[model samples]
Target chain A: MRRITILGLTVLVTAAVLVAAPLLGLETIDPRQVAGGAGAGPEARIFWSLRVPRVMLGFLAGAALSVGGLTFQALFRNALATPYTLGVSSGAALGATLAIRLGAAFSLLGIPAVSLAAFAGALLAVALVYGLARARQGCSANIMLLAGVAVNFSFASLILLVHYTSDAAASFNILRWLMGRLDTVGPDEALRLLPLVAVGGFVALALHRELNLMSVDEELAVSRGVDVDRYRVILFVTTSVMVGGVVAACGPIGFVGMMVPHVCRLLIGPDHRWLGPMSLLAGGAFLVACDVLARLLAAPAELPVGVLTSLLGGPFFLWLLVGRRGAACSA
Target chain B: MDANRTLTPVLDLRHLRLELDGRSILDDVSLAVREGEHLAIVGPNGAGKTCLLKCVNRILRGWRGMISVNGVSIAAFSQRELGRLVAYVPQVGGRLTPFTARETVLMARYPHLTPFAAPGLRDQRYAEDALALTGIGALADRSLDTLSGGERQKVYLAAALAQDARLLLLDEPATFLDPRHRDDFRRVLRTVNRRKGVTVVEVTHDLNCAVLDADRIFALKDGRAAFCGPPEQFMVREVMHRVFDRAFLTVNHPTTGQPVILPEVGGP
Candidate 1:
């Protein structure tokens, strides 16, 4: 009953935020206007085409990254593990940099060329990490972690090379893209990320018990009937795919993947059954809140929501950890 | 468990060999354990005692040989099937997850459950009963990380007991337990073996434990089966010396008349 109440409250807050966020941007949009079907004006287009999609993109990206982070953390049994631990973000950044440098102007299958390249790069990084870290037994956590770090370094170097050789305009574009944005061209980007989040989130939540068992001990999990090797690969692939889509849509928005799950874990306790759903909902709402602040903090101008997430998340997470000493987090 | 089933071994290993990094851990080791029998695997350090249990539990794969449980080849069984047949407790407790004690014990019901389903009333009852049997009921709500080493180990034992498998493979399970808990554990093992008709295979360095608790003693030396016989035959000095590379001073227990093997110290 208590768990349900907690989740119910989260759902309420997330719905409220979802309803209210799209209307509170630089442009004023009435609640009834948002509720009623598309009207004919600049306001209707701004509300329907711009604000709503941007907020949806923020929510999708945040939910995907946070779930990815928690899944990785549970898989590796390390609290510090994040979505980009295996170089997915760095790989996406490199690909996006290349796309910007080459001035790729084509879209395929209703998705932009840059997003496709980003997804491809993210998959490549995961493949490389898996191949390098895999042993006869499987991918051991320590080896995989080290492999991820190495891959990150390599991708970052490549991204630096792309950034350095580009002309001034392209360099600035790369710099701004690196900061991350939730400015959607339409509902398309949000729609693109939706299925990835749904599949990844559903799989992770459905396998919550296995995640618990695996988090405790790989050997124990196997002895208790979990196919550790097979599930390990499944988990990695799912997280990578969701993270790839998110990174493709909005560049690599940092901190949501790293911080949101920790906060959710501390709030809901580490039972992934509850933690999984809570992380997804809270991640979406928290990003919406941050994006709202991003629009409001600098009136008439806006900072990238990514910058605010990383900046706000560091101090907030530090403050959370500072006094409590992870009393709630450790559970 | 039946009279006729006793004629065939419940657990059998043939030509079981394991190699790690080009060096053999277990070389052509073979043994059979009867149903409802308590078999103690006794050996010195690096004698592959733990490795043998792991092989039986199918935790350490890539071994070259046949392992059959209940007359069926282990290879034919899925991991879940194997889990329902055999339970394992490591030399020490596995890593501590964020679950409380009761939650940890409930996880042992995994093999019997479908994916995505929560543990039902029977599973919860078994978990509670296991915790009570292990004398850690008061700690049921405590997170595993907060428990002491001995307490944590008891939680793991409770988990294995709750697993309700036919065979139990324990690797020095009492290494972290207090003497009182050890006595309680021994009694629990006796009841589980005699009353429940469950097979037990324990790896222990303590020879006294073997003679006292086990129906048979299987001694290993350099990963080879040095001795496999009844406890009475295994109590002989020649068998002990061959497996352990040492001299033993054997004395009969004053109360039970069972021979106890102790190390012979020259200076003393």
Candidate 2:
């Protein structure tokens, strides 16, 4: 009951912030001018075309990736597991790099081309990990973790290889994309990506009870009528779709996926019914706050949201590890 | 008891074979536990006793065998159906967080509860009844992690009892308890078997406890049933020595007239 109330308040506060953000006079341009029939001057165009879309994308991507992380964490029973842990981010990066290399001819389909490629890449990465892990007897957690690490490193090296070989201007563009910037997206992109994120998140939330049983113990889960392989496959595909959608819109933003779920679990306990949705909301709120800070910290020249998340999350992660260490030793 | 009524076998294992890493853990084991029967599996460590228990409860799968409950093969039944028929209590260890004793018992009804629905009146009534039966009613609201070993064991037993299963498979249910608590647990088991007609299959190393309440005893040795019959068969020194690989002098108690095995000094 307390968890429900806390989550309810969180949702209300988030909705309020999303509603009140434009009214706060924090943005460089006026949202009213963009919405009204008044001509879209440079400020109105910037507000409508860039800032609004970017903030909305930030919210969607944050929620999608963090929810994906929560699913993976529950599926694998590992706190370190995330959307990026299985090489999906690197796969999406590779796809974007490939699209950029294709040049002006690919611009006809605009952002959809990159998103499609990213979806395919993320699916491919998951397939690879699944195949590797399934080859072992009974699908051990250690084997899955090893496969994830191997696939991530291989894809990351390929992405670096693509970066090094590309032309100077293309290299710069790819570098900026890799550094995780949301400035380039327009409203069209956010609308296009929202459905995939929403569908994936819904499917994940729908599997709450199954995920909760899985979280207890995998063997126990199987004994309780869960087809462990089938559930893992569904979770992998859904999380990949969500992560791919987010990575296609903005570059791979880490930390939100890895940290948000753990924090949500601590607050609401391990019941996935609460943990899953709470992580989604918390992720959005956290990223919005981070994005706001990113803009305000450097003013005109903004820092990458990824940099801020890492700077904050790295220490928090160490503290968590230390705490877990103390807990284990004491026990 | 009506002789005209057909009694359902709570657990039926036929030619069950379990192999792990090329070694047979349970080989061609077959047994039938009838309704209201209290069968105790007594064996040395690593004698496939726990493996047999796990197989019957469907915890460790991949065994080549026929395991049935109430004439339905385990493979044919859904896990929910199987769980409804059988409840397994593992050896107690570690703390399950956030779940109070009532909540833990409530988890036994997971198979019965509809998805996303809270426990109804029936479930609550059953939960209370189970707690009362296991003598953990006072600990219902207490966190399972905060309880003592014996108390936690009772909570776990209560959770299993709340499943309303006819077959209760317990692995070392009294290992963590003192002699008095152990006796209390045995008394509860006897009462539950007699009153509720719940079939109890327990694995224990304690010979005296098994001999006291068990209607039958099965002694396992090196992944095979060395001896299985009435309690009198297991009371023999030769049979005990063959199963346990230890020399023992059998003595008859003056008051109870039960045979007690004492370790033989300088005699094999």
- Best prediction by lDDT: 1
| Whole-model lDDT, model 2 | 0.78
Candidate 2 lDDT tens digits, B97-212 = 44568866776676677766656899989899989988889889886656888888887788778888888888999987998778878878888899989989999988877887
Give me the runs in candidate 1 sitting further than 4 Å from their true place.
A135-137, A317-331, B253-258
DockQ of 1: 0.64
RMSD of each: 2.0, 3.4
lDDT of 2 by residue, A1-331 (tens): 5988979987997787565443332455555667752246766666666676776877888888889988988777777888788878888888877766655334446655665666667777877887888887666766887898899999889888888888998888778777776665467877877898888899889888678767655654554445566777788787887787788778788798988887777677666778888988888877877877887788777888888887888988887778855221111
lDDT of each: 0.86, 0.78
lDDT minimum window of 10 residues, candidate 2 chain B? B1-10
Count of clashes, each model: 0, 0
- Interface root mean square deviation of every model, in Å? 1.7, 3.8
- Candidate 1 second chain TM: 0.95
Give stretches of model 2 more than 4 Å off. Answer: A22-49, A97-114, A222-230, A323-331, B4-7, B94-98, B137-150, B176-184, B253-257, B266-268
Q: What are the per-residue Cα lDDT tens digits for candidate 1 across A1-331?
A: 4777888898999999998898897876876665655566677778888888989989988888888998998898876677688889998888888998999989999887888888888888888888888753456898888898999998899999999999999999999988888987679889878999999999899999898888888888877877777788788898899999899889888889888888877667778899899999899898888898899899789998889999987887677677656442452
